[model samples]
Target: MIRGVRGAITIQENSEKEIIQATDRLLHKMIDENQIMPEYVASVFISVTDDITDAFPAKVLRSLEGWSYVPVMCMKEISVSNALEKCIRVMMHVNTAKSQQEINHVYLEDAVVLRPDLASK
Candidate 1:
């Protein structure tokens, strides 16, 4: 079955390299920790806080992971009051044997506060 997996991270800086590296780390960890196969991923949608415009997080993921065939898109996150800053979030849809409850969602750095329960899991 194809299901969505959520993951997020906060960039320490606004630099392109920092944003890209942070996204790469967060996504890789999410997939590895969940035992997700890269080939099974259908597509990915990434949203970044307004502070992050140096580069698109989805593009960086494809570049770093050699996921050239995976479809990816970028969007801006809703700037809610007191929201985490410099954050990049991902929703990856993939085919997996695990059910939704068994899927792992990663929340790294300052973004971990967004979903304390999932982070603890």
Candidate 2:
């Protein structure tokens, strides 16, 4: 079966370092929480708010030891009024046995406001 894992996190700044750190944190959490193995990941699609132009989140993923073979892409998010800033969102397609309801969606930092229903306790 195939499942999608969603996650979002807010970065403190637009610097490449900050983007990389935030993306790393969010991806790690999502992988850990979902018990996902790198080989099981089909692909990853990531988007960042327009304000974040310093880095591509997908580039950071390449630095991961076992993620080099995983297909990944990053794009700019549609800018909307009242939307969260410095936010990065990711959707990962994985081959997993779990059902949709069994997947965990992660929302961290100020991005938590974007999905109160899925916010971790």
* Candidate topping lDDT: 2
lDDT of each: 0.88, 0.92
lDDT tens digits by residue: candidate 2, 1-121? 8898999999887999999999999999999999998999999999999999988889878888899999999988998998899999999999999988889999999999988888763
TM-score for every candidate vs. truth? Answer: 0.93, 0.95
Off by over 4 Å in 2: none
Q: In candidate 1, what are the lDDT values of residues 1-121, reduced to their tens digit?
A: 9999999999888998898789889988988888876789899999999989888787677775658888889999998998899999999999988988899999999998999999888
* TM-score leader: 2
Among residues 3 or more apart in sequence or in different chains, the pairs in candidate 1 whose N, CA or C atoms overlap within 3 Å are none
